[model samples]
Target: MIMRRPAVAGQFYPGNENDLRELIKKLAPEHTPSKIPALGVVAPHAGYIYSGRVAAEVYASIEEAPTFVILGPNHYMYGSAVALSTQEWMTPLGNVQVDEDFIDCLPIGIIDKDELAHRSEHSIEVQIPFLQYFFKDFKIVPIALGLQDYDTIKELAGELVKAIEKYDERVVIIASSDFTHYEDVDVAHRKDRALIKTIEQLDVPAFYDELYRINASTCGYGPIGAMMMACRERGAKYGKLLRYATSGDVTGDRQVVGYAGIAVY
Candidate 1:
């Protein structure tokens, strides 16, 4: 079955190729990464007007890649984990092939097949145009994470590492997420900074703990948890919070959604 592109394209991002290219060109970093990372990245998935610059920070860090394993929150559907639509995902840019081999290797009990789960999911879809712009040609294993607990995230992450270990292709792990939704501007910055601090310390557990305690409305908590586990397993030593801001900063609104760009190396 064909997986469709479902997002507010022109509204959220530029629909025209030339316009989109120009936007990406304007946002892309002037300096390229000297060495490519294999481990983890956390990027926002809000509209381009709100999160494009922050998202660019993470995407720009990756010089090139043949494959990426993307973990994103299940926004439109609720479940444990949905390995939905192993078909190519369509975007205005082009089709990004799903890594069927890697999907096949996932532990059977952990993955569920459900296309409806992905139909209106913008979390994963929003990242595609950015990936297409930067990488040009690459395949992705798209995994939609649900409301699973932290321990479950760790277990799944371990399985993910083992599943793709034998592949010769260079793979990047991208966790698509937006931080702290619909708080006042001041509140958003304060909460996002606290979370960023935790990420910088590589304290994933502490990050979750603090988020729960403070009720930081980060939607990608599950994906972040999984990414932290995967990064640890891959021996990632450092994390850098590249950019952090809110929709308020972009739109000059009091009510805002937070966006962050992070790199784990």
Candidate 2:
């Protein structure tokens, strides 16, 4: 059995299980509002110190499911344009099962099973611990996208919707992304807020247009688009912005990377 080991342990998050758990306990709110049955969520992928709270807010607000479909950007473009990993993923928390049965439902043509694409990607890897913290028994389907055009995202979303329908367990789609890379805090907020508003509307075209208009350096627009389209197809009403912050908020730096946590239900 191939095991996809943690690539960013100790870097993005703590490598020690105890420390990781402690940190998550602290970052996650003490009082979680009544959780909702969300179809999908958009969470950020960055160092835990920077984006962990945003991720925690999204996770805490949503109800747990038997399976999670995590879509993240291919930062290195290491493998296939659209890559899916069939191997179980390992984090400091433990080995999380990969939903191979669910993966079998997806066609090989569009989303190839390529471990290389996920080998060193932190986007999906960072989200696993949060899942482990909230749910005890669950499986994940991790897909890394190197090609994130609107058409590709839409096609992938359609395939995901079909797969979820055929599967027996409840599932939630997570789009792992971080917005406005390394910019002045004011600029980051302005650009990210515009994109966040567009995301709340579930308007893909306007999101893309706003992204282009500002030339935002968001890392996972494709993943966000896929989640929005898939959730809309599944009858979700809209997205709610639970939290928004940037690295600057943590470190008091002028330049920062924006993070937003949103839930679609």
Candidate 3:
């Protein structure tokens, strides 16, 4: 059995299991909000210190699902344009199984089941601990995208919907992403908010247009677009931004990466 080990445990999050749990508990908001059966969500993938609270808010707001399809950018530009990993992912929390059946249901050739792409990618890896925290029994389908063109993302979303329909299982798609990168705190918020407004409308094209217009350095545009497309195809009407912050908020750094937690239902 192939095991995908944690690549950024000590760096992006705590290496110790107990510490990871404790940190998540602390990052999670004290007031509980009734969870929504969201179709999809957009969560950030920066170091937990920078974006953990944003991610926690997104996960905490969503209703638990039997399977979660996580789409994240292939930041290293490795492997196939659209790559999927079938290996069980390991975290400090435990091993989380991949939903192989769901992958099999997807139309062939569109996504390469390439483990190389996910071997060291941190975007998808960081979200698992949060899942392990909230749900007792759940599986994940992790897709790393090296390509984010409009046609490609739309096609990918179509196949995703097809797989969901065939499997008939409760599932949610999580697009792991961080917004503006390495910009002044004010600049990051300005650009990210403009791009986010398009996302709130569920207008994928507008999101892309605004992204290119501002030359926003969002690392997961493809993943975010894919999620919006798939969720809309599933009859999701609107998206809500549960939280928005930046690394600057945590460190008071002049340059920061924007993070947002949004839910679609």
Candidate 4:
């Protein structure tokens, strides 16, 4: 049997199905678009209470079936390129089957499996409940990206584009990330906005340079980099900064983590 992992079910999201359902309903956009989005979305993955509204913006932009390729950073473990879990992902709602077929089609060395790496990782799990709420009958391709060079990421993105090209599947690609962790609220806002501006311009190299210069602590930088490559290859024309805020806004703390919602099209 393919194991179904439930890493952060109770901590990041509600553990109860009814409660989780209600929370998603409340957080989802009031008016979701009827048209499908060609490009993917980049969303923050913090505690739901802190980042749910921002995430809702990304979900609202997705108006199609439930198949998604969720790319997230490896917060718990580190290894080679991207890690693909063979296990199914479990949440309060149910188990979401991993799209092993798609995983197998990716180029060799592009994907690997490390059960321990995903056992407690919160980034990918935090996005599941929201996905379950919006998409009913869908499959997932969960990738935990580790340290990788730009060329490696670009290669993987290119292969993914080719692998999924022929199918007319309603697929939504999501990059799970949070911006600038543990800085003063005001400072985080300014820094994250600058980063967001670079992202809007579709300038990944500039975004990378600026982020490093400022010592921005974006945990999911690798995944974001890979997503940018994939988006560019898939003809993503523009990016929208849907929402931006810090954890301080939610908890009234002087020090906070930055969160931003971005959509690419």
Greater-TM-score candidate between 1 and 3: 3
Worst ten-residue run, lDDT, model 2?
104-113
Q: Model 4 over residues 1-265: C-alpha lDDT tens digits?
A: 6675677777887888999888888877787656447477788999888899888777766665556788888876654357777788888998898776676666666667766667667888888788777767888888887654566667667767865674456556788999988888888988888888887877778878888888888887767777777787778877888778788878999899998888877
Clash count, one per candidate: 0, 0, 0, 0
Candidate 3 residue pairs in backbone clash: none
Candidate 1 per-residue lDDT, tens place, 1-265, comes to: 6666756678778887888888877877787656447478899988887899888878887556787788888876654464556767887787788887767766655666666667767888888889988777788887787654787677778777777576667677888899989988888889988988887767878988988888989998788878877887778876788788788887788999999998887
Residue-level lDDT tens digits of model 2 in 58-167: 88889999999999999999999889998988889989999988988775458888999999999999999999998888999999999999999989998999998888
Estimate TM-scores for all models.
0.92, 0.98, 0.98, 0.92
Worst 10 residues of 1 by lDDT: 76-85
**Which pairs of residues collide in model 4?**
none
Query: For residues 36-139, could you state the per-residue lDDT of candidate 3 as single tens digits?
Result: 88999999999999999999999888899999999999999889899999999999999999998887899875889899999889999999999999889999
lDDT of 2: 0.93
Model 2 alpha-carbon drift over 4 Å, by segment: none
